[model samples]
Target: MRKTTFLLPIIVIVVAGLMSALFIVDEREKALVLQFGRVVAVKEDPGLAFKIPLIQEVVRYDDRILSRDVEPLEVTPLDDRRLVVDAFARFRIADVTQFRQAVGVGGVATAENRLDSILRAETREVLGSVTSKDILSSDRAALMLRIRNSAIFEARGLGLEIIDVRLKATDLPKQNLEATFERMRAEREREATDERARGHEAAQRVRALADRTVVELVSEAQREAEIIRGEADALRNNIFAEAFGKDPEFFEFYRSLTSYQRALKGSNSSMVMNPDSEFFNYLRSPSGGRAVTPPAPLPQAQVDAAEGAALEAAEADAAAGTAASEAQEEAETDVNNYEVDQVEDAEDGVQN
Candidate 1:
């Protein structure tokens, strides 16, 4: 029983020693074996690993891709415009031995610190070489590649492989933001003013054209009306002339009646004229009594011849004077009676 106890203690000590010499590495990570603060071996594969018991130690590092965000940086572009740039980077540890040697016991924290500095420097350098317009354009991928390439070259010494560099945002500084907006507003206002001026000019041109067209139309209409009125007046004058030529006495009588109708249209009509005026001629005598030119008188020689013939005939007819006077009187009476009948018939026809 005493021997069994003693053997048990020895076996436990051996197990402890074996355990101290062995380690396991996951596929997701890499490890380094350090002796007295010196790197002696690197474990790149997964599964089991070895180390000197109580003499060497193992340090682990992730083998996958990692990301780091760089603090916002201000850069002056080639155009003298300043901007704030926010960025980040993706990277992985390419060499564990070189990493351990560079960072020593600082681990990932120290490596990330140095990497941030590298990215910031490269970002400023690359961004400062271009104008602000290009930085904000769709072709920014090329600029990001430039920064990543530069960072890769600089991070090689720290055992870091830079995968990519990306810009989250590029904006004006807070102090310049309001100023830029004001400038943009002013430019837009100027453009609007120019557009309004052009519109006004075009409207004025159309208005002038319309006004001129109205005047021309009115003038043409007036001319047409005047021409029609002139033609109607000419036709009326021709009708009046034909009526006058056919019968002057009837024309005058009709004209007088028309004048009386127009002058005495209302019950309150009045007139002041002589009772025997020529205007009353048609009213007093229905048969026209207009003056006419008389036939020329006989010549002086014919007057003496007519007087001698009348004397001879008077002496010869002395005996028959009484009978002749009675016969002539009866003939005159018949002629006068015929004239009276003609006048009465004319009056009856006019009345009808």
Candidate 2:
């Protein structure tokens, strides 16, 4: 009965000891055995792991990818502008032995802290080298690549592989954002005002040129009109001279009748000339001869008719004057020829 009792306690203690030495390494974890606070063995594969129950302990580490979102860091740019940035990093323990030696059982937290410091330092270095505009534009990719390279260099001694380092958000500090927006607004307004001034100046130049063109066109039209009017007046005077030169006596008699019609139409005075006057000669005889007497008075309507008939008679008398002038010229020509013949006869008699 004492042997049974001792064996039963021994078996129970042996089972409890084995249970304490044996540990489960899940598919997502790796185990490291530390003997007397020194790393003696590392189990990278997932399965059961064994260790000395009282003298050794097993430290498990995650073998999967780990994500760590860092706290937002405030950094000053090269231009002295303050910005807050949030970032995240993905990493994994590529060398479990080295990780265990370096950080022990702290798993990803130690690597994450070291990585956060490196990321913050390198991010500020790269972002400080450029302006805020470059960070917000196409250069952001290049900036990220530089940051990744810097972080890789920094994390080389930590026995952790930095898979990726990404920036979550980059923003100006609240205190400075309003001032930046105001400056941008002022720049845009200045550009707009300059554009409007250029447009107004261009329009003014165009209007001035158009007004000058209108004046030139009007002056050109007036010059052409004057030239045409002067030509017309010259043509009219030439026609009048040509028609009057054909029969000067008849033209002068018709002009005299026109003058008498104009003068007698509005006259209130009576003439007191002698009956033998040359003016009365045409009224009495109606031909080129001495005047005899004035014609008898007639009714008013007949007087007007008689005046028209007298004008007609005056035109006939002018035609007779032309005939008389031609006859007088012929007589003068005969007298001259007779005088020349008499001179020739005297010369012939002297020769005889």
Candidate 3:
């Protein structure tokens, strides 16, 4: 009974010590064996891991991809524009031995903090060389790749592999948003003003060119009109000279008729002139010369009926014969009385 009791206690102690020295390494993690605060071995494969009992220790770190969100930081670009950048990273422990040696007993926590500093530095260095537009553009993927590659080299010293780095957001700082908008507005306004001025200048040039062309066209037209009018007047005068040279007498007759027409235009036309005036030469003769002749009077009235010329002549002769007989009888009686008185006067003279 006493021997079984002693072996049971000893076996329990041995099992407990073995259990304390053994640790499980999942496929998702890696292990490091440390002794006296120094890394002596690494277990990268998943399995039961062992260490010196009561003297060595095991440190485990995730072997799978891990993620970390970086605190937002400000970067000044080549354009002198400042941006606030939020970034993150995916990483894994590449070498557990090197990781354990670098981070010591602090394990994954310590490694993460150091890795963050490396990524931040690389982010600032890479982004500082580019403009803010590039960081905020579709080509941002390329920029992130550059950051990752640089971070990878830096993190390698700490036994960390940087799988990828990404920028979550890139924006201007809050205090600068309104100022940036105002600047953009000013730039656009200036460009618009320049365009308007150029357009106005072009319009003015076109208008002046058109006005000059119009003036030239009008002047040319007026010159042509004046030349044509002078030619027509010369043709008209030539025609008049030819007609006058053809028949001067006929021309004079036509001119006289025209003058008569003008002088006697209306029934109320009146003029004071001598009867033998040369203006009345045409009235004196149809041939229109100085010859003159009296015109016989024209009978104005005619009997409608019963006007026999022989009967009217006989009645007029009968009335004249009656008046002549009466006068002859009176003369005969006076002559007889006068002869009687003369005889009586002769007798009286003889008596005296």
Best by lDDT: 1
Screening candidate 1 with a backbone cut-off below 3 angstroms (N, C-alpha, C), the clashing residue pairs are: none
Residues 1-352, model 2: lDDT tens digits? 9899889999999999999999888999887788887889988777888989999988777888888888898877666778898888888877777776676656677767777888888888988888777776655777788888888866777777888878889988888899988998777666656655555565556555555555555555545555554554454455445545665544555565665566566464466768786554345655436332333333466445445555555555555455455555555555555545555554444344
RMSD of each: 30.6, 28.3, 42.4
Minimal lDDT window, size 10, model 1: 291-300
- Candidates in descending TM-score order: 1, 2, 3
TM per candidate: 0.70, 0.57, 0.53
How high is the CA lDDT of each candidate model?
A: 0.78, 0.70, 0.74
Superposed model 1: Cα runs more than 4 Å off: 244-352
Model 3 steric clash total: 0
**Against the true structure, whose TM-score is highest?**
1
- lDDT (Cα) of model 2: 0.70
